[model samples]
Target: MYAAVTLFVFMCLTATSHADHHHHPCHSPNMTGFMSVMTLKGEVRAHGAFTYDSMGKKLRFRSNESHPVNTSIGLDVLMFFEEGVFYEIDSKNQSCEKKALQCSIHPMDIPDDAKFHCAMNLGNPSIEGEGFKANVWTGDIPGKKGVYSMSVTMGCLPVSTIYFMDSTTILFSILDIENEIKDPDLLVVPSFCQGQPLEETPEGTVNTFYNEFI
Candidate 1:
């Protein structure tokens, strides 16, 4: 689960450094509302909704992911992002954990085979699809060198509609849209799960979790 989410998030967006924020299509100036999004990557498909404010300080999401590794398992995730912290909800234990997803990378530490990947970028000026005109950007991800692309519509809402790793096409799209989110409280972790954060999920636990849910 950790590897799945981190791989999706960190490798996304334009090659432009994070410092050039205004140009990032994913960072819509109007992303501050509510809607449900569905994403399909590789063999995993996830559906969820989010509510956020304009400041980008708070975002709450609830989604279910496809079972890729084991057909018998299902994964439903509830997460909140604030400042630089990522909080994942463990409903079975009724806890909001902040440490389970932390990871670091050192380019020098990676083996040479892993370093052969080339960076991907927006192919050209974004193209539009179907009913309306939306910006489309394409880039490639390192997993077998897949080419990925996304589209953002009105209010700056975006989804990764097509991602091809090796020879497979992974898709992400918005299932539905609505204005005005009723529950503002969704932006914060539930009180029952608040306090000191839980420890990082151990590698063994991660393996077990994925074994059950992937």
Candidate 2:
């Protein structure tokens, strides 16, 4: 159980870095890594700004039609795994509705620390990507339940992504990864999830929107 929660938290939260503030790798592990796979559910705020091309003509702005990105809001995410299988919830809204559904674990990347465990110096490393440089700060998650926190550098980017048909058509993206940690008590499986481990996907999908806008 411990191992499962640990993996779940690290895996799901790690992938979120591309969305929130850009997180650079930490030079050292600040908190003791969890030995269990945890189920994490919490809120994160996403903020972004964009300008439509005038195309030499003024486009009238409509309040209803305009899908202005959230200046800041929280998100609820879940992490669960067992029997070598894993599951995650990538809800679009804090309310956890289907219509607001974002992405699932259909295909995601769980970075291989052994493969890319680049040691970062003090503070947070500056990871330069597209239009942002993720500033990652490694530390422990708040509360005594044993959690880790990695604050990504928001710099200038969207808070979350709005998915499209081809996965590349992202309407919004996460600005940074605020918090990540393990919770041994989150054992009950959510009815909306199915546990089945799948191959890891590329990180391009997570960063696609950031590259396009930033």
* Local accuracy by lDDT, each model: 0.40, 0.25
lDDT of 1 at 22: 35
Candidate 2 lDDT over 1-214, as tens digits, reads 2233223334444553333333333221111121111112211123322212112111111111133324222222232211222223333321222111122111011111211211112223455432423332233211112222232233311122122232222222222222221332233334544332354544433312112122
Which numbered prediction scores highest in lDDT against the true structure?
1
For model 2, give the RMSD to the true fold. Answer: 18.9
lDDT of 1 by residue, 11-35 (tens): 5543343332234433433232322
After superposition, candidate 2 runs with Cα above 4 Å error? 1-74, 81-110, 117-120, 123-187, 190-214
The superposed Cα distance between candidate 2 and the true structure at residue 39, in angstroms, equals 25
Residue 211 miss distance in model 1 (angstroms): 14
TM-score of each: 0.49, 0.21
> Where is model 1 more than 4 Å wrong at Cα?
1-26, 29-44, 64-82, 100-130, 139-147, 163-169, 201-214
* TM-score, predicted candidate 2 vs. hidden true structure: 0.21
